[model samples]
Target chain A: MAKKNAWWLWAAAILTYLFLYLPLVIVVVFSFNDSRLNAEWVGFTLDWYRKLFHNEKMLTAAGNSLMIGVVSSLASTVLGTLAGIALHKYKLRFLPFLVLTPIAIPELLMGVSLVIFFVIVNQLLGILELGLITIILSHIAFCVGFVAIVVRARMQGMDESLVEAARDLGATPFQAFRLVTLPVIMPGIIAGALMAFTLSIDDFVITFFTAGVGAATLPLEIYSMIKIAVTPEVNAVSSLLMLLTLVLIVIASRVSPSALRANG
Target chain B: MTLQQRIGKWVLSWPPLVYMVLFFLVPTLIMVVAAFRYPGDYGGLAPMYSVEDGKVVWDLTLENFQRLTEDALYFDLFIKSAGYALATTLACILMAYPLAWLIARSPKRYRDLMLLLVILPFWSNFLIRIYAWMIILGPQSAFTRAVNWLVTGLGFEPIQLLFTPFAVIVGMVYVHLPFMVLPLYANLEKHDMALLDAAQDLGANAWQRFWRVTWPLSLPGVFAGSALVFIPALGMFAIPDILGGTDSIMIGNLIKQQILDTRDWPFGSVLSIMLTGGVLLIAALGAAVARGGRKRG
Candidate 1:
């Protein structure tokens, strides 16, 4: 009876996995479709991949997205790590709740507020441009919280006495942090950075609002492209993006599985 | 601690706090202000400075709130959005409970791999995933064709599947199932099967054992998963926009249309504020559930 019950459970699990993976598999399979549309799979070819590579607009958008992801991730990682350290080590009240507000708030509200903020700032200072900088800032604004949360969770698992031991060795606070704390939390920081990178890349709503006339990320480009027409090229680009995201998740999981779980 | 150490700690913590203040807190405050203010002659918040023969006039009004309360259309859209979120959350929970149970009960050797598989797709580009659904449910696609063939073979007319509320629910559940499953699995994995054995020894049947022990223990996961799925589903625009028909306009799309299409900031702000309030209420309820679950545990 137990075996029979487990068998049905395993069947359900398998079906669920299939449901999860089917769309991804279809995308990869259809990316190579010789036909222009995904409706019919005529034959397998690499023409769509070739087209994706050669499309200048797509390439530029990918570049823009990559740059934004890198910059925003780096900035958020720095701010988040510091904030994480502070939250973990200090007694500052209300800091934890304040840091968590962004993740709690919906993305649409964040995007709209940022847009209005930018408009008000632009009207006041006339210095703010709604382009790459705006996009990066907005991405950082959201990504920082996730990074800090991941880092703080990892830090909580750490033995606080290690830093105390370093301090007892007559090392200065900075030196103790540099030698003991930094190396210990390096994995968490790396995991946080990876999370930030993926968040920046996959971000759409926030980027959509902040990106003005001339700025287009890969997501924005894809959105506009699909709005116009669905072609095999989108499948190819999407398959590649999925591959990249999976690679990042793997790397993040390797660094700290708990951090990855916290992120999810 | 010394002043220098306090300063150093402050230095470490200040950047993110300052960033959040400048960008998040200030913007939200401005959004509230914008929502209450009159819309300018053009689109954004009412201009603070208006020049009339070298005289500057500042205009602020409560007309936006008045409009919001008077218009039933906004209330209908909110209800529709809530309905979509509710349907999506229910579907996700139904699907996730079994899968999460399976994963939690799986052998320890393969547990990590199973969990990884569950979460892997969640990291992918969401827009692309919805787009993939468009292909799968497209009229001429193999899946739809197969369904059509099966239906027609049974002497029934072929049904339209894509670009419907059904498609929207499918996409939302697809995107959100992991959110549900992950929390459920996390909670269930730590569950003590000994309790199940205890309940069984106490003469409880499978159904009674599950209800008395497992179900009560898993309430935290249910609450967490519901919040994760419901909040995002409430605000999701791309899923319905990509997979839904013209009739399926959630509050997210409504706000997007008002802000981007119509360039009406005050109306959009009002809608945004309303959406945020609704989300926060749900979040508070989820938190209460979590607290209750903790107390019981």
Candidate 2:
């Protein structure tokens, strides 16, 4: 009876996997569809990929996304690591609530509120307006919460006595952290940074509000393209974006499974 | 602690704390304030004070809240969004549970691979993922063609699948299934099977063992997965915007229009606050259930 039940579950599992991967696979496969229309596959060709490479706007948007992803992830990693370390080591009472608040709230609300704040600030203080800087700032704001949570989860599982041993051996506080604590938590930090990078690069709604006319990320550009029509070029671009994300997830899984697990 | 150590800790925390305050907390507070206030003559949020007779006059009002109640549209959208979210959560739980259970029962080496298969697409661009569904469910796509072929002799017209409520629900389940599965798998994987074996030895059948033991143990995962799915699904704009028709408008679409099209900042803020309040209520209820489950366990 157990074996019979297990067979049905295995069949359901296979169907579920198919359901998850089917859309993604179709997107990838159609990127090389020779016909411009997506009605039926005419033949396989690489013209769409070539067109994507030559499309200046698409390339520029991809570059902007990369630059913003790099800057936001780096900044978020630094602040998030520091916050995670401080919260873990010092046990700041209100820090967890403060850090987790962004995670708990809906992303649409977060995006709207941040846009409102930026508009207010731009009016009050003449220094800033919606642009690449605002987009990066918004990305950093949301990405930091995930990074801090993942790093802190890693720190909670760490052996505390390693840092103590380093301190007892006449190492300075900074030295203890550098030599012992840093290496132990480096996987989490790296995982967090990569996760930040992935979230920033793939963000659409927040970047849509924060990114004004001058700056458009890949997702924003894709949204416009998708709004106009469904083209093979869009499929090609999506396949490439999915490939980049796949690479990041592979590296993240290698670093720490718990980081991805902590995300949920 | 010494003063120097205290100062050092403060210094260490200042970056993230200050950044969050300036960005997240302050903006959220502004949203709350904006919800209570009114929009200016043009497009921005109205200032709390206006200069009248060379003096700052208070201009606060509860008009936005009042309007929210008076307009049945927002209330209807909220209820519709909740209904969609609830349906999506139920579908996800049904779809994810079997997959998660299979992965849990699979051999150890392939288990991680199966789990990764579930979560891999979650890292991709969310908008693009929804767009992928458009192609799959489009009238011209193979899925529709196959469905139409299967029912050829029935003398029924081909179904329009895209830009429909069913399509929106499908998109929601596709996007959120991994979220549902991951937490469920995490909970199910750590189960102590010895209890199951003991129950079986005592003549409890599979159904009894599962209901009395497995069901109670997995309540936390169910709660976690439902919270994750339901909250995001409620506030999702992209899925509905891409896959839903005008008849399927949800609160998120209304909020998006308020911000982008109508430029009604106060109304947008009001909707934002209401959505946030609803999500918090759900989370608090989930926590209560979790606490009750723990006591029972």
Candidate 3:
């Protein structure tokens, strides 16, 4: 009777997992197809990959994406580490809700709000137009939220006695952190950085409004190309993007439990 | 507790706080300022700031808020967006519950693997994945034609699925399902089977056992997952853009058009503020639910 009842549950599980993977499979299969038809399998070829190298525009966008990912991730990492330490250790009572608001707001509104602010800044400060500064700043705002949450969780789960013990043993606070606490939570920090890096790379909407005409990232380029080019070349770029996204995800899974916590 | 310790605490928090203050808080505050300008929404206002005007005017009026009520377009957009969010959240709950349960039940070694599988796809650019959906649903595409045949040839109307609100719902569910699953799985894993067994021994059927014990226990996960999906879904512009054709637009899309395409900052700001209110309401509900769950548990 138990096995019979559990059968429906198993069926539901399989369908859910299938829904998650089916789209990815469609993209992967079509990327290799000889034709541009998304669903049909006319044949298989590597022409898209070959076209990827020859496209001058795609290469530049790819470079821009890399820079944004590295720079923003670095910025978010430093800020997140500091904020995480403070918030986790201090437990400021006033902000139990405020701390989480950044995560709750729509990314679209956040992006638009940032754009409006940048426009005002441009009017006042004259140096806030779309470019590296704006993109990095926008990324740091969102990425810091993720990093703080993950790092705070790590810090919370850590043993407080280690810090107390180290202090009693004539270790400076910095020394204790460098020797004991840092190592214990290093994985979370790295995980946070990895998440930030991936987010910076994958972000399109926020990047789109923030990135002006002068500097276009890979996703932006892809957005334009799909609008204009509509060729197999974009698919080539997509395959490469897929690989990069997979790598970042693997790194995220390796370093942090955010994805794990997020998943289950 | 000590002076430097206090100073250090504030000092460490400053970078992020300052960044948010300058970038996030200030800009949002500016949007509040912009919401009242340039004859937007309510249709009777002096131009406050504009590129063409080359000056800033100061005035205070509830015109934008007034316009929000007059504009059926905006009202419909908000309702439709809410409907879509609700439907998508429900869909996510339906799809995520079993997968979450299965993952929770899996052995430790395989559990992480399943989670990684679930999460790895999210790392890919969401835009590209949605772009993939465009092809699948577009005309002359293999799947679309196949679906068409299934409908037309099989005594059923070929439903206009793509570029419809249904597509918007599907896109949201697809995007947010993982967000729902993980939290539920986390909550479910903590549930003890012994409780279920006890319920069964007390003459409860499977349905009764689930409704009485399992359902109540899983409330935290459900709340967490729904909030995760709903809040993000409320502000999503991308899914509607890709899947829904011109007719199917959400509040986020409306705001995007206002600010980016229409170049009307005040009306856009009004819409933005309204959407932010929606977000706040959901947050309040989420907080209340979380607190209630904690108390009950």
Candidate 4:
């Protein structure tokens, strides 16, 4: 009887998701449609696709975002995983919780302070370019915390004996980690890396302050578009961006085989 | 130390530690120092670490604090930001509660799909998502036209849903609804159905059962959701800027204006510092409330 009553519950859940995603669905559908207005059911067309293909700035921004997201995620994942492993392995003064608190640091403070640092550092270094290097470094700063926490959670349940077994088998310390430890924790690492990638791709506040004009990201371009008219072209681009994100998220949640099965 | 442990200690800790100290901690300390130092002290916002005329010339003074006390404009801005944040959080809760309950009660196979929808928008740029609201709310926009059509069809006046405090709240609620829902779902999924059943057995009605059992258990989720919504909502400038359309200033806007437009770093620092403190205070209060409820339980 209670199970039967869950019909109303099903209706509600279905409607809620529809409300959340229907706009995005509309945008995506219209990206392929001939009409300018999403309110109408326009005939399907690839002019928007053709138009999207011809836009050099948009393509360039996409390339830049991919490059930035990859580099930043790689940096943060390496640093954060190292940090997480260190926190668990070493007897640090504070617990993993304290080390993990930058996740809670208000984004505004972090954004503003990092902006100030880049200015000072750029002034001091003189040769420092504000495009790729600064943007990646700043993203790593924001991302390292979340990655550390996620990896640390994975490390908690992991058996300590895995590494010990490798050592007894005559593997060097690095080899043991490569053979025994890395494979076991690679899922957490990949998950953290993916999260870092998405975050970097979505990041604006920190990048806004740190990134130079030449390195203006898709988010920055979108920010300007909004301030302006936010035309149909931006809508088209947003739909594509959303699609890219969904594909990646679906891939990420599948939790690839390389995670547990990869060579440590 | 064991060779394995030695490598772990240095390899894992030092890189992250040094990066955080150099980038995050040092910069935060500098901003803190910047806040305390008086106006016109840092050689006109340039680097000048020197002494002048027998008075230790440093960029550290009480002028910013003094200005803040006299600054009624800023005082009003802070108040409005807090007021808007409170309203937005309440709106998010009102929308999230039933949605979360329904989702929690749904079939297991469908739950993940529904949850993924909520997170999909979140994965999009926060700014662009807010900008979507702007496009919808702009004059002659699809959302506006729909409202007009609905109102005329229903024989009623067109509702004023855009470019006001109402629009801002609506946008904020839309943007932040998932934060409220996710935490609530996390709690609701774990909630014991038997508690409500026991209440029903005790002759309590549905409302009474909810008040006594369901409400009490779900409080941790509610607190977490409210805190999540409220703290960031208070600091939001972008949403209010785009959706509020005009004459809707928040603390974040004020801070941005102070830094970028007004060039009053000391005053901006003070406001930013106040915002940081506000977040901390609310977080502390949330923890205390949760703690108190547990104690009473």
Candidate 5:
């Protein structure tokens, strides 16, 4: 009876997997279709990919995405690594709440609140505005939490004896940390940085609010194109974006396998 | 603690703390205050105070909150958003259970590979995932034509699938399914196989063994997964905006419209506060139920 029931479970699981992959398969398959319509496949061609390469707007958006991803990921990684260390080492109260609440709440709330905050700041200080800087700041604000979560999980799994032994060998506290703790958690930090970059590049809702008129990221650009009309060019760009994400995930998993699990 | 140790702790904690305070905490507080302020003539917010006859007069009112209550449309929209979220959560659980259970039951060597497959698509761009559905559900797609064929053969009007509430729900489920699967798999992987053996030995059949041994233990996972899916679904604007019809707009869309299209900052803040309150309440309720389950067990 148990064996008989397992058959249905296997079938259901297979169907669920198919459901997850089918739409993505369609997107990729139709990107190569010779015709503009997404309805039916035509003869294969690389025209969409060629068009995407020459599209100035798409190129600029991709460049902005890369710049924002690099800067924000670097900033968030440093702050979040400290946060993770503090969270693991200390019994403090407010730090944990500050680090985790942003992750817990709905992202739209964050986006709208940041909009109001930026406007108010600009009115008072006349220095801040909704642009690349604002978008980068918002990305850091959210990306920090994810990095902290990954790094904290790494710290939890670290062996304390190495640091202790280094300290006992007459290494100063800073030196002990530099020599022992840093090396142990370096993979976590790299994983966190990569994760932050992926998130910053892929973010849409917050960027939609915080982005200035001219500072369109890849996602913002994609949103505008799809809103106007669906075309194989969008499909070609999406396939490339998906390919980039896959590569990042592969590298992240190689560096720290548990980082992916910590994401949940 | 030594002075150096104190300084070390401060160095490690203060940067993130200050950054979060300035960016996350302050912005949230500003939104809370913005909820009570009046909208400016052009956009954003009205000045908080103006000196009239050399006196400081404050500019704050409850008009935004009141506006929400005056319209039955807003109330119904909240209910509808909640209904959609609830449906999405249920669908995710139904679809996630078998997959999660299968992964959990698989051999240890293959488990990581299976889990990776589930999370891979989730790592891709959010808009791309929604766009994929647009292709699948477009009028000329074979999937839509097959469904319409069945509907018209049954003497019913052929229905459009794209830009409908059904598309919204399907998009919600598609985007959030991995959230449900991960937690459920984590919970299910820890179950002891010997317990099932004991139940079987005691004459409990397969169904009883599952119900008595597996289902009760998985409630925490179910609750966690439900919260994960429900809260995001409730506040989602993009999924609805891209796939939903005009009538399928959720509270998130309304808030977005207020801020972006209508330039009603105060009302947008008001709606955001309401959403925050709702999310907190649900989280608290889930915690209480989980604690109650623990005590009873």
Candidate 6:
């Protein structure tokens, strides 16, 4: 009876894993199918990839996504690292609430609120239009929480004695931080930066509200395409994006495994 | 605190503090105020004050909130969204339990790898995940054809699978299963094997040991996972928009239309505030229950 129960558990677990992976596998497999329709598995071909390269809109959107990702990640990394250290070191009341609330709220709420806020600000000050700049700012607003979470977890696991000893050995605060603390958390910072970049590139809902016109990221572009019709080109681009994410995860795990766990 | 220590604290905390206030807190406050303000003739909010007959007149009303109560359509939509979220959470629990338990019971060396496998798909682009479902549930896909064939063989009319509530629910579960699995795995990994052993020694069967021990012990994990899944699933617009038909609109879709299509910012803000209130109430209730459970335990 026990053996039978174990077998049932194993079978259920395996089926769940299949449910998770089967859709993704079909997507990848269908990306290379020669037929335009996604129903049947046709002979293998890379025409969709070729068409994607030639498509001006997709390329421009990809460029925009990369540019926005770089700027947002860099800006959020600095602020998030500072917030992380402060959260771990000090007993501040309001900072944690401000930093973490964005992570807890629904993205739609944030997106719509930002849209209202941007319009009001534009009306009052005659600045801050809804474009790439607004989208980047929104990305940073959300990404900071995730980066701070990873960095704070790293700070929690650090040896406090090392920083204290450096201070006691006639090192100034700046010197101790620069020499001791910074090096120790370097992996966490790098991991946080990568995570921020991935998030910025992949953000859709917030970007949808904030991106008024003339600025289309990869996700916004993909959404328009999906809305119009299904095509193998979508599968082609998705496969490539999955490849990019897998590579980033590999590097992040190599740099700091705990960062992944902290996110989970 | 010393002056230097105070200055150090200021240096580290002030940047994020000011940024979050400007970007996050202020925007949320503005949305709250927007809910009461009049909609602009064009798209945005109307002017707060207008000079009428040499006097300042404030243009604010409770019409948006009134609109919500005036019609049962919005109320029905909210209930439908909540129902979908609840169903998604329940389905996630059924699927996540065995997988989470399997990972927890695996040998220590393989646990990390197993957990990573579960999270890997989630890290992919969100739209891509939804699109994957579009393929699987598409009318032309083999899965749909197979279902239709079975239906016809049973003497029932063939049915549409794509762009239905079922498709929307499947997408929600696929997207959120990891949220359930992770917390449950974290909780189950810490269970004491000796308790199970003791139950067995006392003539308890495997089913009894699980029902009497594991189920009760994992309630906190269940609650945590449910909250994580329920809140996001409730607010999800993309899945329903892409996979659901015209009749399957949720509150998120309605909110999107009021803001983007109709240019009714005031009404959009009202809907958003309601959603935000619902989320907060749920969070507070969950926290209270967890605390109450802890006291009793």
Best by DockQ: 5
What residue pairs clash in candidate 6, if any at all? none
| Model 4 residue pairs with clashes | A178-A264, A183-A264, B37-B60, B37-B61, B38-B60, B38-B61
Tens-digit lDDT string for candidate 5 (B1-297)? 999989999999999999999999999999999988989999889988899999999999999999999999999999999999999999999999999999998877988889888988899999999999989888989999999999999999999999999999999999999999999999998888788888989999988998888999999889989999999999999999999999899999999999888989999999999999999999999899889888987
Model 2, range A1-264, lDDT digits (tens) per residue? 123346778888899999988898888889999987777889999999999999999999999999999999999999999888888878676667777787776789888998899989999987569988999999999988888978888899899999889989999877887898889999899999998998899899889888877888899999999888899899999998888887887778788877776663
| Interface RMSD, prediction 3 | 2.6
How many backbone collisions does model 5 have?
Answer: 0
Better of 1 and 5 by lDDT: 5
Which 10 consecutive residues of model 6 chain A have the lowest summed lDDT?
A1-10
Count of backbone clashes, every candidate in sequence: 0, 0, 2, 6, 0, 0
Writing each residue's lDDT as its tens digit, candidate 5 over A62-153 gives 99999999999999999999999999999989989998998888889999999889988988999778899999999999999889988999
Clash pairs (backbone) in predicted model 3: A263-B182, A264-B182
Candidate 3 lDDT, A53-159, residue by residue in tens = 88888888888888989988988888888878878877675333334557768888878888887876786688887787798889888888788777788888899
The runs of at least 3 residues in candidate 4 whose Cα sits more than 4 Å from the true structure, single-residue gaps closed, are A1-12, A33-43, A90-99, A124-130, A168-172, A256-264, B1-4, B38-48, B53-56, B107-110, B149-160
* Clash pairs (backbone) in predicted model 2: none
How would you order the candidates by DockQ, starting with the best?
5, 6, 2, 1, 3, 4
Candidate 1, residues B234-288, lDDT tens digits: the string is 9988888889989887899988888877888988998898999999899999998
Question: How many backbone clashes can be found in candidate 1?
Answer: 0
lDDT of each: 0.88, 0.88, 0.79, 0.75, 0.93, 0.92
Per-candidate TM-score against the hidden true structure: 0.95, 0.96, 0.92, 0.90, 0.98, 0.98
lDDT of 4 by residue, B38-74 (tens): 4454421454356788777655567777787896977
Residue B111 in model 5: lDDT: 88
How do the residues A113-209 of candidate 6 rate in per-residue lDDT, one tens digit apiece? 9988897788789998899999999999999988898899889989999999999999988898899999998888999999999999999989999
Scored against the native two-chain complex, candidate 2 gets a DockQ of 0.67
Model 5's DockQ score: 0.70
Q: How accurate is candidate 4 locally (lDDT)?
A: 0.75
Computed on C-alpha atoms, the DockQ of candidate 4 is: 0.42
DockQ of 3: 0.58
lDDT of 1 by residue, A1-264 (tens): 111246667777788899999999999999998998898779989999999999999999999999999999999999989888888879877667667788877788899889889988998899677999999999999988888887888889889899899999998888988998888888889999998999999998899999988999999999998888889899999999998997887787787777776667
Candidates 1 onward: DockQ, in order: 0.66, 0.67, 0.58, 0.42, 0.70, 0.68
